[model samples]
Target: MIPALFDRRLIARRRRRAVAAAVPGSDFLVEHVAADLADRLAAVTRRFGTAAAIGGPTDALARTVTASGRAERVIRADVFAAGPAGDHPVDVVIDDERLPFADGSLDLAVSGLALQWVDDLPGALVQIRRALRPDGLFVATFVGGDSLTELRAALLAAESERKGGASPRVAPFVDVRDLGGLMQRAGFALPVTDVDRVTLRYATPFHLMRDLQAMGASNPLRERARGLTPPSLLARAAEIYAETAADPDGRVRASLTLVSLSGWVPHESQQKPLKPGSARTRLADALGAVEHKGE
Candidate 1:
């Protein structure tokens, strides 16, 4: 049997807590990701009548898409209900693994940074594809494998030194190379993937950890160390991080590599790959070079 990668119940509870915390400016990454998705959507000349922002921690995706004028209506879906005060409300509650959208219900579907925590990413992508109409677009951005590299290294080194063994502290992320194949496997046409690395400077590692908690991005791995993390281990990790990854100004660098993905549901009207040997012009002729005979 395939082991569960993440604890969904824990993720939901943490997200709710994060909303309740109402930390100001904690949604910066989500906002950035949402704006990127909107910009990409705006690049497409077509307008979407219905769009769903799935599993977003905040309503940034919905708001950005609406502001971009790419979607006539944007529905925000999340695992949590409306926040108590000073927080965005979700229009629909959904599990990313089991999207409730009916087939062909959406002209556009987007997500921002939330899919990284999903246990079954390929299944989620399939559901998103199935929810879109023919030729409908899907755009999403999530943290790639290169994200949090410094933190992961520091944590591992500290754990190994202090405890003589290291456990799974940071959750695993998907590599950028594998995403395009996964999109094709999920039956999306014209699949495309790209990466944008955003680096944030923190005064100290603790501040970065606090931001992660506020973002509801703390470890949700099923094999995560149970009980509280030891304070000394964290201290050592911070020291190691400062020693290894600090900038010239003494602030630490934390990287968030956002992997942007775009795909479309299959449609006959869309561009298709030419059949083998169908081209009229030879490669050498197109390049104005003499062709060489194969031995």
Candidate 2:
């Protein structure tokens, strides 16, 4: 369900191909993102009328919303993915960063375990804002920094030891602080952003990679494409990952940090008036205030 990274369609397609992947580490990252956003969206669903998820569908979430018989489903899925089989019809059509709706079209826009794959973050945010109605809500959560400290450090060390050069493997992720400003700049109002860190225990580093693959969040790095990962290098990386982040019970702990951001589409329905003194202040009060200011 990934869109183009600066129009990197090939790279984006690779993400979806992770369906059969068994790498535990990558699987953990993908699942981490989906599960993180799932919990967040459930808690904050009431603020909107009909919520629309732009990326891939969350089976549990779609079912919960429809079963409640309160919310409407707007699933934007792959047309080729064995037909639509959800509780409700997939309503709107949206790519990774672009929506078919006009400005201020929907009440709420949400995403989970997505956005990190896209290179044009600001562009995507602008499109999302355009799809919201005035005073509409936007909430999105994605993987961010400190997500895989152990895996990153271990991989770098292993690569340096084996290949002498370690070309930044963690794939850059956004920070919560920068994301809030993007919302405001995109014409969203009162934008707020925060992050949560979820720590999970795993018996082996290999298991973590397998989970990441299952979640469809494997690395699709463009410049790092090589035919083989070299069995020896992977083994060394696993050893380092195990040694550096081992727990008391011999389980490796991975920190999945999620950045949650929310913004409101500017609304003309503001309760505040244009001029407060024009209605609330009396002539005597105004004159007294003027005298006090002069004094």
Candidate 3:
């Protein structure tokens, strides 16, 4: 069996704490992703009878879907309740690894900044595909690619210098290239994947760390170093971060690569790729060029 990469319990605890604290501006990414999801849903002309918003840190996703009038009903599901909900309350507490929905029940499923934490991402995607009705659409965005590269570098260098060794501080993120294949592996038809890069500037490295903690996005890797990070290590990391990642304005840049994935449940009516060697027109004829034969 494949081992878990993240500590689920710790993730839940951190998320719950964030919700309870209600840190101001901590959910900026959630809001940004919610807006992006809304825009994507708006592009679709057809309305969905039922939809599920999975793993949203806030009710932002559900609210956005509801407000779009694209989905008649939106079921909000998360690992932990993100405090009292807004227009749509938390319908089910769920682990991304296991969904509770019945097969072929949902017309749409949307998630924002959540699937990256799932241990079995492919399995979770399979479950999502199974839960969707024929031709049902799935759209999601997650942190991926070279996210937090500067922080990872700074932490590693600092820890190595101060403690003689370094441990994993930032969680590993998926590369954009692999997402489309994952969608195909999960049996989704017409799968599409793209990346959206967002760069945030911070006055200092410590500020960035505090913001991550507020967002419950701190390291949750199972192999992460135990116990609190040393103050001296942290200080050194801050120094290194400023020195290496700072711009002319003296603020450091942090990169966030949001990988967007969209696919549809297979249906007989959906378009399919033409079989190999089935084309009526030759490529040479279409291109107005002669075909060459190799000896």
lDDT by residue for model 2 (189-288), tens? 8777887888878899887776665555556566654577787988999999888899988999888888888887877764544575577666668677
Count backbone clashes in candidate 3: 0
Using TM-score as the yardstick, the better of models 1 and 3 is 1
Candidate 2, superposed: residue stretches over 4 Å from native: 1-15, 18-50, 64-70, 77-80, 83-94, 270-295
Top-lDDT candidate index: 3
User: Which residues of candidate 3, in runs, are more than 4 Å off?
Assistant: 82-88, 290-295
Kindly give the stretch of ten consecutive residues in candidate 3 with the minimal lDDT sum: 80-89
**Which residue segments of model 1 deviate by more than 4 Å?**
none
Per-residue lDDT of model 3, residues 1-295, tens digit only: 8679999999988988877778889999999999999889889988999999998678899899999999889898988764555422488988778899999999999999898898888899999999999989999999999999999999999989987888999998988898889999999999999889999999999999999998888999999999988798899999999999999999999999999999999999899999999999999999999999898
TM-score of 2: 0.76
Clashing pairs in 3: none
Name the candidate, 1 or 3, with the larger lDDT value: 3
